[model samples]
Target: MRVSAKSDYALRALIEMTNRTAERAVSAEELGRAQEVPSGFLQAILADLRRAGIVRSQRGQSGGWRLATEPTAVSVADVIRAVDGPLVSVYDMRPESVRYQASAEVLQHVWIAARVALREVFEEVTLAQLASGDLPDAVTARTAHEDAWQSH
Candidate 1:
């Protein structure tokens, strides 16, 4: 599954916020500058995140955006989904929505397995872990594999 730039920027913004004073709200412009995201695009992303209940916005001199929940409670998948929808899809539809003929029946299981594996990683990883640069043992092990870094 490929994450969109919007999702990536949203995640980066969240990570930046994690490193700041949680009690203080951060303006989109400030976040964009710190994260290197375009200010205009970051505003839209912040709105989407607000709509998803992942963030809360204030509207005055001291107004800005802040996480609605603790960083540890927000998964990477949550941020990605808020901005980009599902974690995995085939032809823009979920794996469960896709049907396969007898000749391709086994392929469905493969797709499902792939989706499950991805969820196993994304679902278990929270923004706190990422912002802290402390990954889980399973995630570290998977990335440590020689094949994990291969171009193809």
Candidate 2:
């Protein structure tokens, strides 16, 4: 399972915004520059986030984007969902929804299990936790191991 570019860009932009005052909106240009993401793609991601209620936009001469809720209240999973569709998808379908023959029946459970493991990390981590460089104990433990840093 891997995060899509949209989700990655959204999270990076959110982290950038996390450092600013909630009342102070950041422009797409600024966010794009800060995160090195394409401004056009970032704008589209931010619009989706706004529609999802994850971020709010102010339209006018003095307008920009801001988080709808506190940084700590926003979870990585939430941002991912707001930008991408689902956490994990198998062949463009949910693992539970797919049917298989008796030999492959157990595969559904395997995919679901994969999703569960992803949630354990993403859902447990909040934006504030990431910005502070103090992840939850579970996440920290996962990173503490040298193997965790290695690309499989």
Clashes of each: 0, 0
lDDT of 2 by residue, 65-119 (tens): 9889888899999999888878888888888899999999999999999999999
Model 2 ranges with Cα > 4 A deviation: none
Model 1 misplacement above 4 A? none
lDDT values for all models: 0.89, 0.90
TM-score, one value per model:
0.94, 0.96
Error of 1 at 4 (Å): 1.4
lDDT string, candidate 1, 50-116, tens digits: 9999999988999999989888999988998899888888888888889888899887788899988
Q: Write down the lDDT that model 1 would get.
A: 0.89
